[model samples]
Target: IYTGVYADGVNQANRRKSRHEQSFVAPEWGWAWPMNRRILYNRASADPEGRPWSERKAYVWWDADAQQWTGEDVPDFEKTKPPSYRAPAGADGVEAIEGIDPFIMQGDGKGALYAPQGLVDGPMPTHYEPVESPFRNQLYGQQANPTRVEYRRDDNPMNPAPPEEHVDVFPFVFTTSRLTEHHTAGGMSRYLEHLAELQPEMFVEVSPALAAERGLEHMGWCHVVTARSVVEGRVLVTERLRPLKVEGRTVHQVWMPYHWGSGGLVKGDSANDLFGITLDPNVLIQESKVGTCDVQPGRRPTGAAMRQYVEEYTSRAGVTDAEYPPIVTVSDDIVTASEDTGTQEEEDDE
Candidate 1:
């Protein structure tokens, strides 16, 4: 911004000066930073005919007779360019750009509901069921995101997500998020006394119903397990993390902060470890926010016991001999709330 506006050559003589200090700078940042734009896409606040869309929201526009783009703010478009101007056929470089188009970076020189390029998945937005869900997609037969990439390795073994028999064993939905007191992973903040004092321990947030069902006490120890790993955290029984009714079944969700690690000044467990490797096609982003896990009321095992404990879960969950949920279409009979209640809901009585 400094280079674009207050560069070496743009002194008072070279640029037009503001009449008053009030007009020159914002009160929040009292220091006058020359040519600082308060808004982006200021051109959109006006109409293509060079008029404000409305008097209440006037921004940049063109004055055709003067043949200049003028407004309260400096023009993003070429100053001298008029609205009627059009780029010639096969014009390369800047000449290829259009006057009315505010977002020139786009291939169509306009906003797109569908991407023309750079989307690894597809051009248009399509709804895919979450990688882990208690319910199935009703609109289509496909139970989960078919495009989602799951990794299979000795170190990063994934859980049976959906359309699989064993998925029913690890019943609760879990999501990892941040707390107000610390930043993500808490690499630096956890070591500090002030911030760590505010949120002292790594804990899991659960609803009253979930706590009652699992026999978890407020501030008591609990183990959160996934196919990859097991993590122990203090259970925090809170009304904030409520259970939702999905497909006629009361589905419970647990919340945990990802700020903890196996090693720290305020050590507990790395909540991130409780996840398998699943990547988004385009960005290769893991669906880190939500997954499935069974919350047990007790501390997690260590070393060899930990491996045996995980095997016990997998063995109970019917993960025998490298079994995984295949990409498949689900029948409505197996996935309605009434039939899916605690299991699969067949039909709605209502």
Candidate 2:
């Protein structure tokens, strides 16, 4: 019912066209979702009376002569439904929707600045610090999102955050992304000669200031250390990775492409190894895109030494085996409680 192209013949016809000068929507070129409607809520392109807001920008509008909605693309609304048509009192389902209502999914069929439901965090958007960061949240008393998901396991150790001591141990910020030359995890692209040639080895990009501070030389080998694992990459001292001034402190950021891995022909340390598995509470997506780590010049230790190297940093940073950082950190009471618990544990050990 959504895409009207039903058979192989219809699908072929939709895909045959190369270009159309008349309309950019190209309804005939290829099918779109929701009964082949190209633009969702295209009804909003016109005024309440179903007239185009501007002739040049004309999209879907009501055809008074045909007494139905007509447009370059399929009408999102019931085709026969006129603009003036209003639902009577106590109407149910689609019948309850008014003629002026463009957002059919919403209860009131209107855009909402604040959602009434269907959100785990809250209605309005609020800024919360990342699960791991070098700085404390400056705006609110809360350091990070209280509703964020945390995997409190031995393997997925978390770096220290604000209100916790030794956050400076992992002082630099690192983020991971993709490079166009290689596909995700380099599964297909890495084996191919051409693609592998484009990005021969994994590399980390750092700002000039960070390079100077860390004594990193361009094209030299360096390793990024986190509580989880250490991954080394060839140093690329570039201005693309900028140093930002936050809270009157110059903060440096490191960036790497998460394409290369051990299995790939163009093998290098995987940037993903540097991240811990923290997730958004709502969607459960791993928040591994950004985190904090320490950058050191040279390759990371291998085998048993790698484990010890990571543990050394965690120990120095005071990262405990206690449950992931307390969810609600806005109150001093919670911090005090956590400290008290830590003190009691130390006493018990004594």
TM-score leader: 2
**TM-score for every candidate vs. truth?**
0.74, 0.77
Off by over 4 Å in 2: 1-110, 333-350
Q: Scored by Cα lDDT, where does model 2 land?
A: 0.84
- Over 1-350, each residue of candidate 1 has an lDDT whose tens digit, in order, gives 34444344444224544455444323223222444555555666767777889886677788877888777766666677666668899886667667776665655456666886878666877677677666677767776666777775676665666566677777889989898888889988888888888888889999999999999999899999887788989999988988998888888999999997755567768889887777888788886468889998989889999999988988787765565667555666755643559543334443
- List RMSD in Å for every model shown: 9.3, 7.9
Q: Model 1: residues >4 Å from true position, as ranges? A: 1-45, 50-85, 91-97, 328-350
lDDT of 1 at 186: 91
